[model samples]
Target: MNEILILSEDVANMVAAGEVVERPFNVVKELMENSADAGATRISVVVENGGVGMVRVTDNGRGILPDDLPAALQRFATSKIKNADDVYNVKTFGFRGEALAAISSVSDFSIRSCRKDYDGAEIRIKHGGTPSGVPAPAIEGTTVEVRSLFANVPARLKFFKSFSAEEREIAKFVRFFSVINPNIAIELSINGKNTYTATAGMDMTARAVQVTREKDLVYGESEYEGMKLSFVTSLATVQRYRKDMIIVGVNGRVVKDPSIVQAVVTAYHRMIPDGKFPACAVSLHVDPDKVDVNVHPAKTTVKLLDARDIFSFVHHNIKNRLDDAGHDQGVQMRTPDSTEHITSNSYSRPEPDTKYDHQFATQSYDIASEMEVVEYEHRSSAEIVHIPEQSGAESAVRVVGQLFNTVIVCEKDGEALFIDQHVAHERVLYEKFIREAAMTVPSVVMYEPLLINVGEDELAVAEDSKDVFDKFGYEIESFGGESLKVSRVPTDVLNRDIEAQVKGILADMLEERKDTSVDYRALVMSCKAAVKAGDKLEMHEMRRLVSDLFTTDNPYTCPHGRPIVFKQPEEFFLRKFGR
Candidate 1:
């Protein structure tokens, strides 16, 4: 018997469905693309139970003809293209014709359509079964309903996510589409509750505001080589933890083009802090012949003919706009306040005093003339308390003063010890937290919970590290949307910026996910909660910090492997003075 015979048609379609319809979001994407290609002005999408139970898409567009209803479900059948040559110049979104076939192969699918020349018709198919069409009432457009998705493939159904998570993915796709097609009204509902909707006829900026939920935006426009670019980017002040807020689309299709996104981010590198991402909605219109949309199975990844040129164009234009805005602000600053009439370049170099120069020239050169006499009130050597010769805890150390408000200068054993106050405090806190984690650390309940808006990547990291966070006395819960509410924080971080500390911890944890042995959570908490350099400390606080540092098991270095203390021997100073 032949072991590798061709699979049955039903089985073949089920296998192909895996690529196109990976999740509920893909279903929504393919259906919406079809609607857009049909010249849809208004589209509605309704899903129940995270699109596992049902997904219905209704579009008021030029629907399919009654004669073409059956072939719409046939494999490799599509009206978007006629031959192989047309594939190179494809413009429509549903050229592969596999979306509907693959979708119907895995789910119970039905399509109802009405064209101008024929009466409305309905087609029904069950899991790659033969299609059946019936005469129905004349509905102006098409409505595709899919029920019990992945019912035939139980293994795929098991991998479905929570309803809310799935709905969020669908919402993200809808928002991207809405931003790209501002003239098309789109509504999305989950379990009969309207979750997102965008009205038609909004201009680019207005539509971007509605889609990104950002109001402080700067608009940019540039055209080159038949490609037109329009983008609405968040001000440099507006930053997020992840790049998920940056949405890029090419020719009315939302794509995951990394080069374009990198261009925008590189432009803002000098303006924003590191590890921060600015929200942007960039729309690029290029001729369909110059780009290839058939690269990916989902058609969300495209290859541009002039990708490098596009990137350089976007980068320079955004950078120039930001520079112009900064220049205008500088001009405003020098516009002369009510009392001053000084321009930016108003200061001029003054002439030297002639009398002092002439006197210096006439006088004899003497070293004593450069020095000033001083009277000192010296203390007796007997009154000084000398440190012990032993290098143990028995020797006492006295804090002299702080240097540059960053390091603590202490006198010990006839030597000076320069301690990095920040690292000393960090080491102390790290050990303290390690001990507390073994036991139970007290959690301080906040009167008002801190709401942290995180991108999808950060949220995933947080969700994965929930138990670790709970162990460290951080009580975090998803508070709807892309936010997490923190009702309780570690007592060590009570007065600190709880949101920034938590997000920092999450970001570090994500970076260190592969290394399980590292205590990133504790390290992050300690670093964030510790007193930083340049912070003024009272005498008592300095004494207490020094005392705490000595008590730690490892007082010489911080948790991040930075030296906390540096000692200079008296012999070294004597050698410096040529003793």
Candidate 2:
């Protein structure tokens, strides 16, 4: 009658299986990691029925040994680490041997491998953690096959999603890994068809082109403190995710550190439109140890030894590229009106602040006063501001002319502003959209409220914001079980499909929480509705955009750190024309 009884080996393994083999995707992750650790130049993954029925991973690596094949599939066994101390300096991708053992315990699993120096070997194991026979001769490299995942654990089987959903998740992981290790060739196939392939040892631009199918209009490259930083960014297309394809790496490993991503976002802030994510590939080559890769179990995250220094370094690198591309106001050369052409009356402003009651908002007075006194003069509401005296502040130059419904040209004092009219206007419109979004309160709709279904994890977030939504005039009733019914949505967004807008709002709010500190649902809604790059704008509208931009609270950048305006300075024109 002991309170705790010793469980059988089968029971112990089943428990472990629950942790490591949650789904077929988990099996694919483990096998892919093993193949990566084995130094595979090319790794190919094939999955069937979302990996519920079959998952196969083949690698052209050194492969496993005949003598070690049995031990490799045993519980708590690992070749990557010998003792506990080795955990600190561990570099291999697959350090936990629990992957194979746990996978074998819950599904039919087989491994075939051959080291370059030895003969091939093969082994098969079934659910309940037992090997059938000794290792036998096989082909070179490694091929792992897992079948009927979670068959022994029907409870886990219940968690299996639709095959297409699971397949997408697996495909996402494969693409992530492929992007991280561009030097390693990777091929991912769904069922029998190849879904994706990456060229081995391609440069960052090449890799991005191959993976994203988007052209790499790399602006430029530069070095900071002896470490080279390259900017592989697109001119027009932006990503459709919370984190736009801004992948940062040091010494060839992928990292998701906020500081690094923040720096890049900050650098581009105000250059792009609000709520739109730019596609960028920023690769930094520095000493490997500067980054500690042992921070996370999956190594998708990392710790930078000098996070601040790295942040500043990368921020400046991107900032300089933007400036050189005539993305900053100060150094650009063009007509102020032509660069940011608005209608004659579109750039209206408040009367000059002669009363000196600037105390209402003091912190940003210098910038505001400059705009009020200098920018508003000479330019109609449709015209852009041109400031020759303030060459240091690139933002002083505003758009003067919008040509061919595509390019914006701004000139002030001795500087000119030439910008991709679409991108610049997108930034302006996006900012306005964000402002409109923030001001709009949700309206209560009494007619059969729409129900928003969410998982348990998302329930808390929805609940916490319920009151906030109420303030915006939205009434949400809890469905008692695990869902929320929306009785109302914001009125301004009424033009959009109610269901689609609400769903988009919720998803965007959740993503904003992850991407930036501003998590208000209203703000997220605004960001998602903002105009995107490649959106066309008329000349007068572009001019109005420039005028409105100068009046914004954070016109220098967007909410997410992308620059909305680029300036051309007089010095550049003087240098080119020799005074």
Candidate 3:
């Protein structure tokens, strides 16, 4: 007998299932892709127990004929391509033809499809067995149902996450597809509870808003060298803590291209403050011949013929839009007594002023010196603070006086309380803005819209962030090549230099840093708008600040994690004076 023998078909299919059907999400993805390729206008996905118990997808598209039903479950059988040459130019989502075969080998699978020219047919395959096909009720589309996934493969079942976690993964993928395929009405149900539904006929922007839950997005379009790019991006002022909100699709297929994502982030460089990412939906259309979708088994990664050129193109276009929205780079603003203003070239000692005492000036000098003298070095992650919930005790605190015009002195229950003026004010303003943001804040329309001249790069950033400006009450529009017109301003900053404030907001949007929960735009605005160190406040203002600070949710720290209030016991005085 020969030493080597061909593997059994069932064993081979089971092996393929390891790659093609790694999880329930994969099954859903493949089925939905097939539906899309079939010209599905309406797709519905229903799952139970995170798809471990069941997964069903229905599509109203061109279905399979009874004659083709058996072949649809056979390995290497597909109508997507004829020969190896056609593989490079493949446009449909499913070309490998292994999805159904591999999926059926590990679970109970059935597909019911109806073609306009042929009688309806149904195919059933269980655990890699021979497929059984029969005539079924006449229908106009296809419905694929998978049950007891990984039932025959106990080892694979162990790798699955909890029901809720797995369901979240499925929901995430569905939302992504819904945004990219706006023309398709997508509905998802988990455990019979309708989770998500996007009605058909909505444009890409509208779909993005529905999926992302963000209303401050600006739409942009650009065509470059036979490629088209359509994107809806959040303003530098509107941001999320994580990069998960950024969605990118190539040729209508959602992908995980880090380079493309980085290009988009780079476009906002120096326009958004560091440690924040803008929420965006990017759709790229390229010639099928210029891209290869066979790079990964999952088909979620692709190879481009001119990746660098594409990256540059995306970067330029996105940057131009951001600039046209008045988010041009190179604008900086100063915060009173903030260490951010200290630089080696401009570092100098300040003369004492009557606004603050020597102690406050000394503290500011120390902070500035620490910032200026320290050499550049990477810092570790920030320390997490555990804040207890608020209670009635906070309301009893009373303001005493100001210390060095920086710290507010207060008295409560025989304890001396000291609050950092800047941090305290930041907390108050943060809460106030958050509350105002929940409502419809008023706006101030400019009598004459201000015209701003910008470079190509600036124009892109401005245009991309126009909607963001509008959301914040600044109505800005493109005024022809490299110029923007600002017709409205945020009521809060009407008295300030509108142009300078616009530039500052844009610059902050482009700056890069670590991820943070602090809204960089709001933080920057609050910091600028708040009363700073060395500003003398009347007794009533001090009392009002202390009163308002106590009313906030977290009175101890600002939005940026800086401590606001410090406490000292009366016993400390006894120890100091030896009473």
Candidate 4:
């Protein structure tokens, strides 16, 4: 082995820059966050050449003290925290203090600030050189300007996409940040052209409307155990094709937590199309210690300590609000041209950024390829008259005949039972699979790994819920961006439409079995593994299916909430025939 050696400060700073500054947009993010942390009420960001030429962030917050100007460029020097404990109780958007050090090491950087007690001062650094300070013009706040980002390290420039892509990222961040921090006025300019301005004093709803470019939003608020969640979402009438519209922020920091995203998708399960998403601006506020913001250097992803509880909180509150909106919409439709029902009350629609299956995730999949999309005909309450079978009664049920080779016809006393063969099998398989689930359930390892294309958002959910999927014997691994490779699957669900089953699992089937884990995998697996509509069954198979169906706790409905068994009494035939 060769002798180990320590890297120089310049080399180390560049290495840290690799993590802290990925692109020009990252430089803008760090500088903008600094302005916010400085208590700036009015902030402006100007970018040129997609922020590769120059990025200037100006703020009217409390300027950096003259004495701390030089120290601010030192690595690990930050006023946000003083001790190790402060890391857990951070209130500021930036605390690591590596941004400036890492940024200045590879770019032409300058910071100018003036406090009320002292005269205005400015600090400038050129590619990690010795910092120079001088008495600058008087100002009440701070201004950080970065030019030729990564100029010293041309290798970093190679990783960036075109200027348009970089500019889009910067614009996306500004729009999301403005929506979350409505109290601050933020201005953005690209290539010297004014993009947009978010004026101060606007509430979150108005700001969201202006930034999101959506209209007629609904507002909702809910608090549970000191945690608070408020949202401005589009009505059920409004929808978009992409999942990019669902912007979520926590404690003033915009993040992309999959748990939170799943909750939002679950809330709008059947309200939107199976392939569309809604536009929503969700703001969640909890104590600082409750969330881990240091998961990544960018701080765009967070790990919630109480993810399950938080999921419930987000889902129930938004679902309840949407339910009320739906109710109000009904009243509005009855009154011709009268628009005071929900529009006057509160919202905008939310479409997920990576909406793949009209559920959660980033990319789209042709769900109709593997499985037939069931189009249940719309029927009124009067048209859908049927009796629900009592869940658990030991009355004997006998298999009479098979209807259309689909439904298993049965008889118990004076009532005729029409049981959907597919759904009945699903119920039976779901209960059995759930009970046998363990750390690594029985699975079928395929010779060739099945590849599935999904959105980033959908992949995120899959990656996050790895444990849940493992119980159902799914071995999913990232096959690069927006694709997943499955080497193993649950034994019963083998050879079935794994793609459709994955979509259903990530889509509407995240119903929690109890207080702990979500059982979405079992529901989807059972549905996929069950017999098809035209799969003819023998008398013995039908009898065994009917016997196994009634033994389940919920024999009347399938795991997907569809009716499994329907009942018709002999009295109905007598009434219709005038007997």
Candidate 5:
């Protein structure tokens, strides 16, 4: 055969399709992005069979003219980027024109759009880069329909997940966009059932209530130069859903810059329990050049020109707001009339379970139950005893230090260990409280039942633990359809934020249950009431920490599977000092 190599345009387009269409969700993402780019006020997405059977996105944005329908389907052709120079100052979400060309190559794709002056027109195209028919007149807005997403690529079909899983992914993506763009109405439906719908032009609190199902009462807001930062941190009673609610942005665009997330976390580092994440959202406005959005394909990640400055800005913004507002994070009370938006099917609570590790054989020892220990007016001064020590070849290497308030350092004979302080405390508390929670416990009053409205999703979790609550000295009852009332509280949580503590308990239940199968609710409550890091500790406190750490089942690590301690080898220290 003569050496001849000329690839067809269809082959090149198919190659490009791989990047634009990775999974069924990508189709919905692209179409939705296009709708937002077109200035659509309302967008709706309908999917069937995880979007493998059918995917359609409708937007009420400025539609394409009849003359532009054919050209819009062409590869590398775009109305988004007029010239190469315009790429740097680009602001729209869908600048890359590869979405349509790529979609058309993999499936039966069609677009129906109408410009302001002209009637809407529909253009249909089949696989292999050929138009099945010409554009025909249609409706007022734009709607794109895609069928058999990977029909032309059978190899890709093998990777599709279960319909429910795919639907979850789609739901998550849609929810994020809906939150990011609160002014634009978004509706999502799966298998002919409505999954999510958000109001157009809603305020930040309204949008937050829609997404998180918690209180949207603005705790505080502040202005810095040209930017304004506002937030409504969860009260102690609200069930926490994340370890850190570190949403960041420059001029309303959500970016995954580590500095931003880190700064926000740092702002509330002292306030939050080790593993619990606070709930808040912050929006910033800045010059585009100062923030680069071209970092990731999904646009979630970004590179800021002045990351340190941005970090400082966010920190100051949060601090100023909190200080000025005099917001009492320690208060366990909830604002009345706060609405919760969650469905029964949004998330469910798990049944009681227990998990035990068999890797290490147990050694019998005398220990008081947590409740018994707490009940004693004065802790007994028991003699300090050291356990059997490891010797010779079998001894494990260890290293240790403190990083952020929640991190502990440990290095074993040679390996490095970084421990999460919060998780470690969680593990320790888990071991202590699980036992206390099983017995009939007495009510220890810290405060009167602080009525707090919880999100429906979180309420499901709280309701699941009614029996556990009764056992742990907590007299909790449903206050109303949307709230929880506490007549009695955990004795250990005296002088603490009762509402935040309860929310932390719910969060702990959800997180640790998947791994340990233990009474995570009790564990969460223990951690919430425990002493946090960053509080200046005396020698006694540090000694107690070390001693308590060693007493645990796995002294080397914390509860969340992160190391609890790290040590630097003497030789390394000597080398550094030039001994």
Candidate 6:
């Protein structure tokens, strides 16, 4: 048997530093959080050499007392909480008191603060040297400067990716902090140059737009039970390529919660392309008692007591806001009355219970008396008419005709619409499958069960996500070690190789937990069932397809993120002809 020894204070702190500060970004995160908790309306962070060389955070918040400045650098010392009971009811960003002690252990650290009507004081420490306080300028805030991070531990410094990489992480964390804490103004300086800043007056929506440099955005808010959620999300038209932009904050503290991320992504589901992600900053305000933020070493992870309720709340709120954005995201189209275009624009948008007679023919009339045709003689046929698909549908809108045997051209109000036939159908069928299946898609039993080979981790995912697979329209079970038994498959996917798709579903489920995600079972089914490009269509077919498309949840894009409808502004034709 081995004997145990109590580690010295320096060694214990260095060990704890590993968990509290993994990289330069983490140091920035901790300091930024402390600034916010200090009630600083204005905070500034300066980083150099990817935070390995230096990090200085200054905030215009309540300054620490001269007496408390020294103790603030010691482990297990925090004024945010006084007793064990205070841990459960923490409302501040920092309560553990481990940040300063852990951070100062591995770096040259110093803190300066001055309360109102008091002399300013500063404390300094360098790799276990004796800490001492000195007189500082009587500033009404706190400034923490850390230099030579991981300098004491060469091993830690060697593991860093690069200076630029570290700088990016610091910048990323500060951005989230600024947006999440909209009431506070935050500034970031990298490599001696100011790079990013957020205004204290700006709300979450404005902050999000400024930070992302994306103008196409929307705002949503909802309060249910005891929880409140506010969001600044990108419109479907905006294309951010990664899910990393979906930032989540709990009770004003930025956190790493997968549940919240999945909910937000699912809310955008078919609205955006599957491979794309929306840039959303979600602020969740809840009672401190309802959440436990002490779960993670760096205080990044949190466990919500009512996680499921919060998920639904976040998902439904974002979903409803997007739904209200309408089919064209506020694009205005007035009824067209131009010469040579179709007439009788008297169609009313259908009511939920209203049924349309698909069998009826479209109305038409001669445009000779309405207006004289401009001699379009100068332009060639190629210049004047591009092939879309054939057009039909209502006299309410003019089906200008088809283009390239693949797209449908139509004029509505003042805009000329280009609709993709294949994507239009895909979007339609996708909505149908989702609506019909509700929670679980109907699976078809196979004559013979398929045997699939999988690793232990995948087998666990297959078993755990059996219900998710069911939602994806599959009935799968464990066939034993390194293998899975699939008895049935979604009716839409019967023709595709069940074995290959099953493996794919498992791999996907493993990435995102099976409990929260569905493999988008209808995606494959809808794609396979949709019309292909180059398929010729009649005028009535184009019109009908367009009509069906406009009525879908999203007419701007298809299920897989392809644009289903595009518009050429009314000015396009005017400028082209020198009219």
- Give candidate 1 misplaced runs (Cα > 4 Å): 1-3, 327-527, 530-579
Model 5, 98: alpha-carbon shift in Å?
A: 1.1
190-217, model 3: which lDDT tens digit per residue?
A: 9998888889867777777766665556
Clashes of each: 0, 55, 38, 27, 33, 13
Instruction: Provide the global lDDT of candidate 5 against the true structure.
Output: 0.64
Task: Give the Cα-based TM-score of candidate 5 against the true structure.
Answer: 0.60
Better of 3 and 6 by lDDT: 3
lDDT of 6 by residue, 511-576 (tens): 444333323545544554556788788665665576667766787877667788888888999999
lDDT of each residue in 144-258, candidate 1, tens digit only? 9999999989999878877767877888888888887777999998898887788886666677766665555667788987889887777565666667778888988889999
Which stretches of model 4 miss by more than 4 angstroms?
327-579
TM-score of 3: 0.59
Assess each prediction's global lDDT (C-alpha) against the native: 0.77, 0.63, 0.75, 0.75, 0.64, 0.75
Residue range 262-327, candidate 4, lDDT tens digits: 788777776766676767889999888888778898777888888899999999988777677653
> What ranges in model 5 sit over 4 Å off?
1-7, 134-137, 157-161, 216-245, 249-254, 328-579
Instruction: List the candidates ranked by TM-score, beginning with the highest.
Output: 1, 5, 3, 4, 6, 2
Q: Worst lDDT window (10 residues) for model 5?
A: 341-350
Question: Per the 3 Å backbone cut-off, how many clashing residue pairs does candidate 4 have?
Answer: 27
Query: What is the alpha-carbon lDDT for the whole of candidate 2?
Result: 0.63
lDDT of 3 at 494: 60
Root-mean-square deviation of every model: 13.1, 19.2, 16.4, 16.0, 11.6, 22.3
TM-score of each candidate?
A: 0.71, 0.54, 0.59, 0.59, 0.60, 0.58
